[model samples]
Target: MGDLMHAVGYRKPLPVDDPESLVDAEVPVPTPAAHELLVRVEAISVNPADVKTRRQADPHGFRILGNDAAGVVVANGPNVSRFVVGDEVYYAGRIDRPGSAAGYQVVNENIVGHKPASIDFGDAAALPLTTITAWEILFDHFGLQPGDAGTLLVIGAAGGVGSMVLQLARARTRLTVLGTAGRGESQKWATEMGAHHIVDRHDLVDSVHAVAPDGVDYIVSPFSRGNIDNYAAVIRPFGHIAAIDEPTGLDLLPLKPKSVAWHWELMFTRPILLPEDPYQHELLEKTAKLVNAGKVRSTATTRLGPLNAETLRDAHARVESSATIGKVVVTR
Candidate 1:
């Protein structure tokens, strides 16, 4: 390994169309800390988080912005016990660290998982972030059990996290899954992922009621703004609602009558706040097993190109458009 590595970073936030939004440069290769692994990044997938970070956060200096990655461990800290050199791994790395938008990155071993053997690096890269988010929302936040039978409504069902939620709910639980999509292509994609019914985003309350009149037992929404009223109307008494988006002026008083439970899910919480938690790694391992068993499949629908400033910019633009049908991955 050399002292310097190729990387894509930005000194300041700019529009994706700007040529300097993400610039190619050489940065020093970072060394692994205790319980950390130095990985040679092979593939990366862009998520809304990446776009949001680029648009809103002040890096203060050149900062690499990527979270979902599949790579091979080239080195490890002295205290690392979960993996060794040359192990194929995947993870949604911590936001506080230098990210995967470079030739190599250092991620803690406790939050990493072995890549599914059945998929390539690009496909594997698409799973970690969405998989972690969906799994946490379903099992952790919603407190769902294996034999639980009810209706689960997924808003923005064709996107990365929703796709995984539909698949995991079908494969691991007895719940009837319903997905909302605004377009025909997205509706079809949601059905293919395992949604038993497709709800029109425009007529959320009516369409969701048409499929499950009793009301959905659980609702998971990636796009939560301006939809809380519909969610309140369709959620049954004592039902659960989980949202990943940050919506301003969100009024929860509408759900007071039903005693609806609300949850906020952020997959980075474990890595950023509770670094000692091993559940994220275990969850990823379980997800990898599901992928290997063919119960869950990769949602990488668009491959921009190799990992570089140009491809990363394109990937960010696609995600920021809010029309992506699935994940956009860039390979090394």
Candidate 2:
């Protein structure tokens, strides 16, 4: 345990456009600091950020990257009382730090939550990153109050975060769920996940009209790999639009007349910067409670083998393909 542990890392950014980019290597096992928990990783989930990071990692150093992980505590830092050693936990660790694609990881106890009792480690692993993102985007950013009688639209409603958003909104809120997905498979996925109506993105406004007849009050789009201009048509007057994609330029001028609100959600914002509110972790624990009660199940559709470079790349590729609905996970 004293020696270095295994990790998935990159020596230099290479073309995922090619294949020689990511690598597996022995890396130092991090020691927990005050308020930190050193977790023995049991599972990890690959996200779009994983692929992006690999392709954009610093060429000068070994860049280790991953985001979502569920594991057990092996050690705890000083002043830590929220968890004891051997407690099973899950968290979408900070994106700025080295990742959970390793044997052990150092993460804050505040960001970590008790693993959902209903599911195993691999299934539990898929929920954290996407859950946090969907929760924040729908509730926090878009301000979709649970019973506002407002209609909520989830664009790209078949992917990981979108799927969770659909479930969470439908389960926790009274807002009518309108899911926008073009593919037949995506539409089926959305319907099964509790969407009131499924709309196509090609002609979003018309598709939305077929269901709402009026318009949606809240719209959330975590799928921004495409352009950002599409939401303007379906979004109602004074409605709110929330997204978690990159800061691509979208004309905000159109949204002004309706007093519409456009907000961005970055799940890592809280943990990466160590914001004043530590209670978000408490909220994630509450999510765990809902999941434990069997109101929700793991979104992970595919599970891979022990964490290694090849497996990590494959996970990343799965994420980047943007084909999988729900999460694709990796476990040891």
Please tell me which predicted candidate would have the highest lDDT against the true structure.
1
Per-residue lDDT tens digits for candidate 1, residues 275-311, read: 9798989998999999999999999989877789998
* Model 1 alpha-carbon miss at residue 297, Å: 0.2
Alpha-carbon RMSD, candidate 2: 1.9
| lDDT, candidate 2, at 273 | 78
| lDDT, candidate 1, at 117 | 97
- lDDT by residue (tens digit), candidate 2, 67-174: 899999999999887899989999998877889889999998888899988889999999888898888877777766756568888888887887888888877888
Which candidate tops TM-score?
Answer: 1
Worst 10 residues of 1 by lDDT: 221-230
Enumerate clash totals for all models, in the order shown.
0, 1
